[model samples]
Target: MWKCLERVLCLNCAFAFAIILARTGASPVIVNGALGYSVSLSPLTSVSQGIDEVVWRRLSPRMKLARCSQGSVQYFNTNYTNRITLHYRNFSLEIHDLRKEDAAEYEVITATGNTGNEHSELFQLKVYGLVSGAHITVQGIFGICNLTLICTVTSGDPTFTWWRNGEALVNDSTQHIRVLGNMLEVHHAAEVKYAVYKCEASNPISKATAEIKLRDVCKLDTSDPLPNSSICAEFQATRSSAATGSF
Candidate 1:
């Protein structure tokens, strides 16, 4: 048995200790899944001369999930059934329909029969629910779309992605668009006019999207002189922004 040096680590803090682990290199396994999503954990070497056994364990609960030897795999934990598949060709552990309880550090220990040597790999799995109330608001101009599109989600952790007409949005000054965290600054470009903007919030297991076409949501007439109209000032602002080539 290889002697174990005990240390506590969370995935978020794994990077600080990545260079210390030579067997797994300096890369931290960032496996995140939303609730009810699936994730896989694989050993560093898929094609090693391992003739003995492989063990998969969850460090938090000290639960042995699977054991494989001589190409035969066994599940010691009944909590996993169709949810796990060791036959995934890469000697990887696959867990399906993840639950929050499944979040923990996972370790893969392999023993070589001929050399009587054991090697280990460690990583953390974080599971969370999807973001609720995923929506965007337009603040600034109207027809020119030169406005700040702020995306708001109930959850603070899920990654946020912005899309326009099914295409992912990128922050390029040439394209007159900028993405700053959850806020998207849009300029009136050929691609920005009247296009639907989608904000997607997702975790490993859950994904939610909300889209809004500001043009459709706010009707403005540049010719409308009525100052009392809610959108009249927006139109005036759009005209002013048009000089900046935003229109």
Candidate 2:
């Protein structure tokens, strides 16, 4: 709870400063990165109060600074320049051909038009890499027509892709993935149709996918380890039997 509040406060403060800079006709900019995402940094108040100069810095493993007036300044690290592009008008920095090392915090500094009214705001940049190790399962039955779908990724990026019979499954209006960590949950599973299901992890450079085939309750081979089941002991049999009877 405290951590959440801290984040909110920090965001609000950054916004307030951006507002003050806009009102003063001060240069305000937002620095962030995106591969498939289109993000913009808007002056929180659109009123540049006293800010005269705006600067954006990339802070990850090392500090790379860029000036609003000058396109690029001397950077402590050399790797960022080739991958980073600056947009001074909106105070944004776009990272191209992202890499895993690009994940970290960034900064924005504003100098007020007056002699000594300067302040700085820091923003965080996270680079998501290619994801891997995905599995899918079905559970939670409501009726002959109701069920649930669950997709799990053991590691890698948070993004997930659900496929049925080797084709991408279209999520329904009522379907949503759980944002708690990286778990993907879909409610209201299909009633009778069963097929090969897959979850693919994606990032900038490559993708890895895991697949599982779902059979009917009558044809499902409970004789073998429930696909992807880690349980190797007879305990799996006992547990499966007990649960099957109850349901």
Instruction: Find the candidate with the highest TM-score and give its number.
Output: 1
Across 80-149, the per-residue lDDT of candidate 2 in tens digits comes to: 5665555655555555565556656666666656565555555555444334455555553223323345
TM-score, per-candidate, Cα-based: 0.51, 0.42
Considering summed lDDT, which 10 consecutive residues are worst modelled in model 1? 238-247
Query: 5-88, model 1: which lDDT tens digit per residue?
Result: 223335535744543464465454767665666777767766456547888888788889888888889898877767877752
Candidate 1 displacement at residue 149 in angstroms? 8.1
lDDT of 2 at 161: 62
